[model samples]
Target: MSALPNTHEVLLRNLNLVEGRPALLGVSDAGLLPECPVPGLAMTEHAGLWQSLAGDTVWEGCYGYEPEPSQGGSYDTVVVFLPKARAEFELRLALARYLAAPGAVLLVIGEKKEGIAGAIKQFSAVAGDVVKVDSARHCQVWSGRNVDALSRFRLADWLDWSRVDCAGVELSVAGLPGVFSVGRLDDGTRLLLETLAESPLTADRVLDFACGAGVIGAWLHGFRRVSGGSPIRVDGIEVQAQAVFSARQTYLNAGVSGDIFAADGLAAIKESWPAVVSNPPFHSGVKTDTSMTEQFLSQVARHLAPGGELRLVANSFLPYEALIRRYVGPVEKLAQNRRFTVYRAVRKTLG
Candidate 1:
């Protein structure tokens, strides 16, 4: 186990505000429940965090914005550990308000480096009369009243949609706050799609690993339709709840249907795919963490059907070539520019 995150540190210092049962949203797995005065509902959308807990306290692994109540009922206090995106912050604020009981308090805690100071302004908008309660370990805690709003949170209402041209077909994309490359296509994905367009893969099912907003999957569906190939099914796996919703909307908006659900990496995938295309996420929060992508590369081969292919795009600086060769099979560089490189690996079949 690692040291407690700074946000949890701030949470520990202000335990006095936790009146009645509380809801700890966006919680990490630092084993902090042992010290808390009351055992609150420890909730996190993150798959990694949700699975890391020891079941010492009540845990809720939510996949969507709306949080459900525990057996004890709605919370008297809702503690939100500020997310990495401002859009997500607002979403959490709205969600916290919806989850708390009448006259319940809302607490926001985060490190300064994670933009906790700027969030105080937004927190005040939803949680009126917000005040800084504590500042320690480079983290701050703010408390306020949870006021009911005029509007309810609909996940569709928060989506940011955009259109992109791929493989001679127009595709729609939907993204929520905190999702990677939301509202616009990123250059790396553009390069990967361009490469795929030059040589399309024919498969009944394709796995878009870490599929952010279903960009790659939607494009492939459109590409196949335009080329007069058999209709292809798209399977997307995303860890973030917002991205899962965004990807589902993206596929729906594109008039292409398949499955898009939340999962921590490939842990939930059982069926092998004929092809897997991804521009996998490289960052875990604000830091550049490639462990997820590396793990995907290491385990993806086993999840591929015989003669299946894995295609992905990544920054040129990252060392993924060795990992791919070591785990998947022989690798081939498909395309490259100054910033990104696309690679392909085919799973070997026994004679």
Candidate 2:
């Protein structure tokens, strides 16, 4: 298998810090913080990434947006691993400003291809006088300080909300920068919603796996309401905190009630569902990863009630039909456009 990106190594090697300083790491990978000079607190919304980092004794891990108070009083240094979403990057910067003690150092690291240079300008706005500390292995590290002791950061001010019409139902959707399809509807999800409109699938409970921005779940709720089916309950599982937050806001704004949680795929869910729907994720950071989707296919059987259905939309090129049949049961192609395909699979009866 090809190696994942090496930006973490570059960041670790080039980080300039004194020993024993209390530190906080934001949105980082597995091994990045373990080798740092200071014992650190790491935060990630990705459950799989958290699992990989949980065993490291060098640093502690938190699985959500904010670190618990018991993690430490305050930190002398905070490092943010830049994500692709500009809003999320700003949110992390705001968080770094919030967590770092006055005059404490704040560092940001990312690959040049991921636009580390552009991020420097944004970093300077919140933290003062950014300086490039190191550049190697196609990644650059920049550092600044929280000069203003009285600066207050509010995450709510950073959210972007918009009105969208899906399947003729106007709804409000809100998302922070890093959430998928941040301020608008995605074509793949739109196709899935269209498919749901014509399908005969009905259930009292449904699962929205990989429910980014909560679009699929919220829309499904709306569809079920219009179809006059028995009141349907929706549960959404997302791995990113921002996406989970956005998903919750989407449901709330649309006057829909549902449960959305930050989790690594199906790991945290214990309930078997009558229907499962998703426009599953295929990419992680800058790497093309099908493993997550394949894992979902292989494990979804255990989460489905007898004769339950799994409906998914994917790019036409992914070989999901065979995998769905092998793991879940019989599969059928529901609809396909030039760029996307929708598939439905039924859970088979056990002997």
Candidate 3:
């Protein structure tokens, strides 16, 4: 296994603080905790991490993309690996608090650049008595004590929703912290929506890959309703549990008929669709990582119905045209502006 991240390493530096059963929250790295007599629970919002740890012998409990805490406030030690989004820390803190027992050793570990210091400050306001436990590898581990508190965690409570106009249709978009373009419609997505609005696709069923907050899918549904396009069944695939939850909320509130689920890229999808639309993500954390999107480009052809098309929006600078042409079929640039470009590729039909 690769070496533990600096934040996780700092968390290990103060392993002595662990009490009874332990709970790890927002821990992106798997296998960080050693095997204990009582196997601990490891949970993450990232589907990739959960997939790695699930069914493993070390952790008795593993949950991914689940908002509810399965083990109620039972662990005496709770460690929260800080997330990059400032508001997301509160959501993780709420989860950590719900999982930890009264007087549990609550540890928050993260790199300085990820805003660990600010996280502790905000955590101190709620639970109080926050302290720095350890510092190493440009990361710090902070500790706090959990209060005796029990309130059912409602994912809806954390969502921030807003009404935005896309394709001349007013649609509701809800997003949790860390979800892409949470409160506002991003330029790329807006551009894609406008282009699609002008010439709506003929697909009866649509799959929104990497759909964040279901904006693309929801807007399409509303536009079709007003403009008399073919009715579409929307299916969204998101990698983050938070994004999945938010996307579901967006669809629910907007009266958009859709299903949104968490998955690592396109791994969970099997059925082919008439059209696949996306503003596919290309970042892992704050870093630009294109492997996932490239993988999607590579495998999407198999998931397309005969003569089906893939419509997507990406940054203007990304080199996805070659990959799309190589994998799907002939590619056409539909729209382009200063920051983003929209492309469409159709799967070739057999004679």
Candidate 4:
């Protein structure tokens, strides 16, 4: 039972959500990602939301664009959803400013507590005043005309976030402004990475699921390279291009050979000789989002060969042991602190 029960099912019923030939920006789980057989023309976000949330069946669009494809659309209107971050919403609106033609309209929809008003003010340059859509379910819609447009020049603030290093490694992290644990390492994540210092996937292909800023990935790579173990390779899977970019920089900075994909790389992951590692994402806003982590647990078991392991760190209080038990056998706790718990599970049999 998902929070958005039939999230996929509901998405299918909303085929009429999009209208005419407008290019849609800020399409995430709630807005777009067609559940209906017929896909929308286009979407924008950290990465390919349509493919994961719904499926590849609705693949009728351009995706994963950097400086994203804002301009060049013949679209008379651009629908912009107020994303989670005010700063991110600002950049997205700034990008859309150039895309909308003169007199064109920008439609924004979001939850009231998510700060949609601040977005309206940020985009005032390429627009007029605020116009709210129907207010239902605590969500509101608003619009503005392209009366004016302004360059934020704050592009780097939302895009070029970094982290302060502790321990032995000082790695760079790229993050979109509004993302969870943006611009730094999570307390739990840092604890997990520090504990896993003794374990390295020597000469094995390693996948860092939900890799943010490539912290865990680079940490492992650096230690293994120094230990002189078979030159182990790294691969990361993240849903955000910004996070992917930061992870890629970690690889580049390490001068190590690895792949970091913005796509949902964890979904298709199937490696016979590999080690799967993660500090999986388990929360969305104030709510718990176990979908990605559950999928990651299942996939980790599927990807590892005989004796292969899935090492993970999670909040100590979460009932992850049950989820881990569902996919892996003989699950064992490795370590624990007041805030976090680490586990090592072996892929005993084919699920």
Against the reference, the lDDT scores of all candidates come to 0.81, 0.77, 0.81, 0.64
Alpha-carbon RMSD of each model: 2.5, 2.8, 2.0, 4.7
The segments of candidate 1 whose C-alpha lies over 4 angstroms from its true place after superposition are 51-57, 69-73, 148-151, 349-351
TM-score leader: 3
Error of 3 at 57 (Å): 5.6
* Models ranked on TM-score: 3, 1, 2, 4
* Clashes in predicted model 3: 0
What lDDT tens digits, residue by residue, belong to model 1 across residues 1-351?
A: 667788887788788989888888787654777677776677676756665553444544454474443422277888999988877888777778777776788999988898999999998887779999898998889999877632355667788788898558788788888888887889999999999889788778889998988998889888888888999898998887778888888888887768986778886678788898889888877789999999898789878888899899999999999898887778999999999999998887633
lDDT of 3: 0.81
Candidate 3: tens digits of C-alpha lDDT, residues 69-175? 56777788888888878878887888777777777878888888888777878789767788887788998887788864455676677778788987679987887
Give per-residue lDDT, candidate 4, residue 150. 41
CA lDDT, candidate 4, residue 333? 81
**Residue-wise C-alpha lDDT for candidate 4, range 1-351, written one tens digit per residue:** 234322223323333443445555666554444333343345545465645533445443444334333444344566676666676676667655655565666777667787766666766645777666456556666667756654333334455647546456566665665555777778887777766665544436777788877777777766665556666777888886556665776578677567887766455555544577888877775588887787767666766777787788998988889888888767888778898988887777763
- Residue 32, candidate 2: alpha-carbon lDDT: 53
Runs of candidate 4 with Cα error greater than 4 angstroms are: 1-20, 29-41, 46-48, 52-60, 64-73, 148-158, 161-164, 199-203, 226-230, 349-351
Off-target runs (Cα >4 Å) in candidate 3 are 34-38, 57-70, 349-351
- Could you give me the TM-score of model 2 versus the true structure? 0.90
Name the Cα RMSD for model 3: 2.0
Candidate 1, residue 30: lDDT: 41
